[model samples]
Target: MARYDAIVVGAGFGGMGAAIQLDRLGLSDYVILEREADLGGTWHVNRYPGLAVDIASVTYSYSFEPNPYWSRLFAPGEELRRYAQHVAERYGLRRRMRFGTAVEQARWDADRRHWVVTTGSGELTARFLITATGFLSQPYTPPFPGIDGFTGRIVHTTAWPDDLDLTGQRVGVIGTGATAVQLVPELADVAAELTVFQRTPIWVVPKVDTPIPAAVQRLFAALPVTQRAARLANTAVLEAIMVAGVLEFTRAKVLNRGAGLLAKAHLRTSVRDPETRRALTPGYDFGCKRPTFSNRYFRVFNSAHVRLETGSIAEVTAGGIALADGSEVALDTLVLATGFDLWQANFPAITVRGRDGVDLGAWWRASRFQAYEGITVPRFPNFLSLNSPYSYSGLSYFTTVEAQMKHMGRLLGELARRGAATFEVTERANAEFLDRVTERLGTSVFYGGDCGSARSYYFDPHGEAALLRPTSTLNAHREAVRFPLDDYVYGGVPA
Candidate 1:
């Protein structure tokens, strides 16, 4: 069996970040396991049309390695993928990484004080395990009736084929999440007729996306500080929005009301049909669900060839989609904009057995998914999960990865300092952290608003919110840095 200091699963931003941290700590014996043939994780997998980042391009990159060559304010997926590859190649992570290796299961060996990971190729052991598999790694397609009967081409945004073409073909997209918002607009321009199936409406804000001028790019390249300033400026605006829209409900109510009004005005201007505008508008309060930004989304409905179906999908016929009203829409292609299983406990599709053979999935099923500072969980010795459970960053996902990677580095450092072979968060400490996290989460608009009834993944089946961290990004960063090592239990002989 191959052995290493640490084993990181998933080659996304989180996994790459973890690898970089390990390298910086001089622990060069770590390998990143990527399921796909290449790095960039989601960025490499998702290659749909009109796919661009919702966040500003300037702030989307790592704070340590800023990219000054971003073409637009909202960068497309390919650029981000290239950036990920660049980061890996620059840090010499590509050679050490094991691509096309999918981890099947990981079991903790109590006697050896290490993890035995089973993959497609063979078994590998590591003193420490890091799961950076990402939240949206698993794409979920709802089992609609007769969905298999559809002879037409079926596509999901997560696994978009490169050679697949929809030009001059009748296309139907089901679900109106973030991907649909960007895709429908692109499809409208090419497809002979585009039909959008919506079960619930999401809050749409204007995405003020613009190309970064060549001179500005040149300036950013000449003076790196200027790009940093731009990133900070964008960060400040996004932080303020998150604070107003979630952290402070009283303030959020006012701010979100104003934002909603602006969205309404945009909708009114874009969609002239009163019925279409009404159908697009969400009934729940803003911030109840994941809010999306798109300047062209609302305008897509204005196309004469585009049609939005608000009724429930009765079933999928061989010809096309059948509505509950006995109406059928013929289509040549079917695109399931259906999102991933965001809150599913069985993520990564890996069976992780901790001490006493405790299954991670069963544990989460029995109790609410809780983690110490969203990184380590009780009973999971020498394991850290990045961007999982409460570790999610509201303003930026990069913040979550940064903080967790830093914290994981600290844990590894402490292990080396004490010569301990194993470290796990104490049950008492995990419980105490949960007490505080749940209390703080209650104060957010997710609980105060009508989010419980909305089609949001933020709230779990038990009415508990576990998707995002309740505190501000700054607070999360500070907490990750200042977290006391005494909160965990370190064991085993000296390394």
Candidate 2:
């Protein structure tokens, strides 16, 4: 069995950020274990048609490492994959990565003051463990009756196969989420007959996407400050929509309403038919569920070959799908763009046993999902979860990563100063943080708006919108750097 100072259970940007922090703290004895054979987590895994960053390319990346060569405002999935490779190479993180290694479980050894991580190959121990296995790691395929009996090609957006062409084939897509929004248009162009099964309509606004000129790229490369300004501008717009319009809905209702009206107007202008527009329109508030920016999604409905089916799905047959209205749609291929299983499968991603044999998944299910500062949890010593509850702050995931990096810096610096072997958040501190966030969420759209029909992943089965931190990005960053050091109890021998 090998041992190290730390073990990071992902190779995504989150895990990379954690590893960078560990390196900065002089704790270089760490390894990154990735389930896939490559480094770019979602970027490497998801290769469906029309896949691109919904957020602007200028703001989607790490603030510290900006890619000035992005071909378009919303860079394609391939660009993101390349960007991940660039970051990994630039940070010298490739040497520490172990691909094709999936961690099955991790248990805290109280007597030894380390984490014993179990994988298929063997077990490894580490003084600290950071689980950055992204929130969208697990893909969900709803168990529609007779789905297994389907003889046609069945594909999930997450596990899209290479060289699988849908050209001239009758295809059925079973989602209308962000991935489906991007993919449906692409499929409609190629499929001889296309049927979209939308359970809940999604709110989509017009995307301001355009290719970046070579001159503009050169300017950004020469003066990095220009890109920084652009990123700041985009971040501000997203902050207003997410923080003010959603979290501060009680006070900034106008902003939220204005956004909804904009989307409605876009939908009205794009779709020719009034009934089709109505069918595509979302009934819930704008911020109830995650929205997407798209110029082609609504317009694709105008195509004669495309058909929208709002009827409830009864089951999947050997031939095709059966609807609740006794209608059937035969297809050569069935695509499941049902998105990720967040609340159930991905909250913990892997089994984690902490002090006193406390299972993290069971605890979150039995109680409320929470993490102290979205990093540390009580009874989980020397463990940090990058994708924990209230961790996601803004539209750009990089914001969350940078903020958590700051948090790790502060917390780990204190640990080094104290020469402690382990650090765990106090139960009182964790409870206080959870209570504060829950109280603040009372004003958010997920809690106050008509989210019952939205079917948003933000709300768990317990009806708690514990996904995003109910605070501005600036505030989250500030708190990350200035959080009370006493909240955590550092113990054991000197490092």
lDDT of 1: 0.86
lDDT of 2 by residue, 17-114 (tens): 99989999999999999999999899999999999999999999999899999999999999999999999999999999999998999999999999
Question: Which lDDT tens digits does candidate 1 get at residues 141-221?
Answer: 999999999999999998899898899999999999888998899889999999999988888888888899999999999
Q: Which pairs of residues collide in candidate 1?
A: none
| Clash numbers, per candidate | 0, 0
Top candidate by lDDT? 2
- TM-score for all predictions? 0.98, 0.99
Which lDDT values do the candidates have, in the order given?
A: 0.86, 0.94
